[model samples]
Target: MRIAFIILLTLFYSCRGVSQSFEGAWKGDLAVPTGSLPLHFSLQKGDTWTGTMRSPSQTRLDFKLNVIEVAGDSIHLQSAALGMSYKGRISADGEHVEGTFRQGNYTAPLRLGRYDSTQTVKRPQEPVAPFPYNVKEVTFENTASEVTLAGTLTQPKAPGKYPALILVSGSGPQNRNSELEGHKPFEVLADYLTRQGVVVLRYDDRGVAQSTGNFLQSNIGDFSRDALAGLRFLKAQATVDSTRVGMIGHSEGGLISLLLAGQHAPDLKFIVSLAGPSLPIDSLMVLQLYHVGKSQGMSEKQLAKVRPINRKNFEVVKSDLPAPKAMTQLLENMKSVGGASGTLRKELQVMLLEPYRYFMRIDPVPFIQKINIPLYAAFGEKDVQVPAKENQESLVANLAGNPQSRIKTYANLNHLLQPAKTGGLQEYYTIETTIDPTLLKDIADWIKGL
Candidate 1:
C-alpha cells in the first residue's frame, strides 16, 4: 500500500510590496495530536505569482500550488488534487505568515517563519559510506513494458559467486532507496545485507527518478514484469550464483514477489515478503480502512457508518464491468448511500483509475497456494496498513504445503518496521527509526540460511 501526503501552501499579501518579500522561502510547523509536521513553501514572483510546497518530514518532492490568490491583507493557496488549502494574513513586519491548514477532515493552526536550514529530521539507521562493499549504479530493461530501470547494486568486496537478492519497492513512485518520510529503508537494507555477504540490487520504480516509463499508467502485473527483468539481469552477473538468486519485496513489492514465485519464474529460487497481503484485495483494503481510521482516532460509530459504503465501493471496482460503467455504478451507489462530501467524491473518482481497479480484484491466496519455493514473510504487529493477524492466518493456511516457508510478525512495529505507538500514518514522520534493527538481522539470517 502507498502512503500519500496531503500538503498545504501559502502566499503573501500583494499590497504594499509584501508579496515581493515573500518571494523567498518560508517554513512552518503544523501541530497535530500526534506531533508536529514540518512544512516548507517557496514562492516565486514571475509573470504571475507561483509557489510550491513540501512536507520534508513526509516526502521530498515539492507539490505545485494549483491556486494562489491575494485578497486585501489575506492570501490563500489551494491544491484541488491534494484536497489541501491554506489561508493566512501577512504580519506587519512581513516576517511571519499566520494561517490555518486544512486537508480533508484535519485542520490545524500554522505559523510560518524564514526557512531554517539547520532544522532537519534525523534518521540514525540511514547508511553512510566508508567502503566495506562495492556499490555500482546499474540499469536494465523490461522489454515488455519498454521501460529502462535504474538502481544501485551493492556487493561484498570479496565477492565470489554468492547469494543475490533483488529488492522490490512498495506502491507509489519510489526511488531506488524506497525513500519515504525522509528515510531510506532500501539503502539501509542493502547496506546491512551486503555487509553480511549477500549481493543486493535495489532500483527505482519506472518513471521515478532516473528511471524511464510512466509510473501512473502501470499496475502490479506490469511491475512484476519489471522485477522479472531485474532478476534476469542479476542472474546474468558472474558474481551472482544463478541458482541462488531470489527476491525481497516490501508491501506491493512483496505482492510482486509472490506473483513471480507463483508463476515459477526462472532463476528465482526463493522469495521474501514484507507486509504483503495473502487475502483478497477487497477484503484486505476494507480491513485496512477500518484499522487506519480507528488509529487516527475516529469514533467507532463514525467508522461503522462508513464501513458499508466502503464495501459497496470496493464491490463496484471488483466487478467485471468496463471502467466507465464501474465508475458510473460506483457514483450511483455512493449517491444512494448519501453523506459523501465533495472531497470524498473526488477520492472515490481516484478509485476508478486502472491501478486501484486492478488492485481491488486481486486474490493473493491463489498465488500464495501455488508457490513451491522457499519463502519468508514478515509483518509488523502495529501495521495498520496491512494488519498482521488476518493476513498471517491467510498466509499460513495457503502455504501449508510449503514446509520451507516461514512467517513472522514483530511486536511494536509499524508498516515500515519502525517501533511505533499508534501506527498511524502521521506518526510515521515523527518516528526516527526507519527499519527496526532486529527485523533487519532476522531477514538477513533467513536469506543467508536459505
Candidate 2:
C-alpha cells in the first residue's frame, strides 16, 4: 500500500542578486537516518522564475515549485502538492546551496551542488536487450470498466505451453514495469520468470501510461476488475497453460490477489503476495504510521500523541457519512494532532480523497480466510511500511485452512524486496538490487511446483 502522507525533499534557489546564475541543474542528497536521498532540480529564469524538482531515489516525476522567494542570501522553495519546502543559503562561490528540507514535522539537512549529468544511479538487475525470451507489447480491453489496458507479454523462445503469471502492482500510478525509486521491479521479475520458462504478463495500471482511465477517481474494486481482465487475456494465449495460471501481487496488488481468490476467480490456480497485508486496513495503517514514523526518527512521546488521533481519523474515514461530514470529523479529530497548520491541512486533503476513504474501510482478513487455493506470502523482516511480524502472524492464523499455503520472511529486506540496512523508504533509492535473488528463485520455484 502507498503511504499517502510521506513526502520527499526537493531543491530550491533564488533568482535575485546572485553572482552566478542558478538557471541550470542543481543536485543534492538529503541525509536521513537510513541513508541519503538524492534530489535534483532544473531551474529556468524567464519573465518569471520557474523551476521543477525531481526526487531521483523516490520517483522520476518532477514537481513544479508552487512558490519561490528570495530574501538577502536566503532561498526558499515550496511545492504545495508535495507538502514540502526547502530553505537554504547560497555559498559565496555560487556552486553550493546548504539548506534544511521540511515535510510536515520531519526535517533534514540537504546540501546541493552543481549537477554533473554524467553521474546516474545504477540498477544492475534491470534486464537489457538480447534476451532468451520473446517480448510483445499487447493491449486488452477491460470491458467492465471500458478501459483499454496495455502491457508486455514475455514468453520463453522455446515456445512451449508454460505456467502463466499476471503481475499486479501496488497502489499508485504504475506502468507495465511497476517502476519506482529509479527501479523497474516488474520488468526485472517478468524477465527472470520468462527466462525460467514461465509466461509472464505485466500491465500498466488503469489511467497510468499507455492505459486509458481516470486513475485518481478509481478505487481498489476497479483495479481488481482490471486484473481479472488481464487474467482472462492470458488464459486465451496459445503459449499459456490456462489451468496453471496465477497472480503475483505486490502490496495493494497482494490484497487484490486475495480478493480475487476469495471470490474464486476462474482459472487462477495459485497466488503470491509480496508484503501484502492480512489485517484490518485501519489497524494496518495505524501500525504503518507508527513504524514508518519511528524509522524516520519520530520520538516515542510524539508517536504516542499521534496514534490515537490517527485511529480516530481513520474511524471517520470508514464511516458511512457523506464526504463533507467525514472531512469535518477528520479535521476536528486532527485538532488534537497539533502540528503546523499548513501540514495539517495538506494531510487532511489526502485523507478526504476517495481512494483513502475506500481503502481505510476494507478488512482483508475475511478475504484471506476464504481462500482455498495454493498461496505463497512473503514479507521483509525490516519492512517498516507493512511491519512484518504482526501481518505475518495474521496471515498464518487466517490461512490455516489452506494446507497448500506457505509464508516466509526474509531478513534485511525492505518492501521492494531489496537487501536493506534500515528498511526505511529512503534506502529504496540507494540500494542497487531490484529484488532479492533468493526471493525470485523462491517465487519461481513455488509457482512451477504448483
Q: Candidate 1: lDDT over CA atoms?
A: 0.78
Quote the positional error of residue 416 for candidate 2 in Å: 0.7
Please give, for residues 1-450, the per-residue lDDT of candidate 2 as tens digits: 666454211101222224455667788755332123467877777887798888653456799998777666677889887789998777777788767788776565566788665458899999999998899999999998899999999998885789999999987667788777679999999999998889999998876668899776788889999999999999999999888999999998998998899888987899999999889988987888888887887778777877787788778877888888887777677665443234335445556666667878889888887898999999999998888999999998888466777899999999899999999887887899999999999998888888
lDDT of 1 by residue, 56-92 (tens): 5444778998888876557799877567899887776
Error of 2 at 410 (Å): 0.8
What clash pairs does model 1 have? Answer: none
439: Cα error in model 2, Å: 0.3
Q: Estimate each model's TM-score.
A: 0.80, 0.81
Model 1, runs deviating above 4 Å: 3-41, 44-118
| Model 1 / residue 140 / CA error / Å | 0.4
The 0-to-1 C-alpha lDDT of every candidate, in the order given, reads: 0.78, 0.80
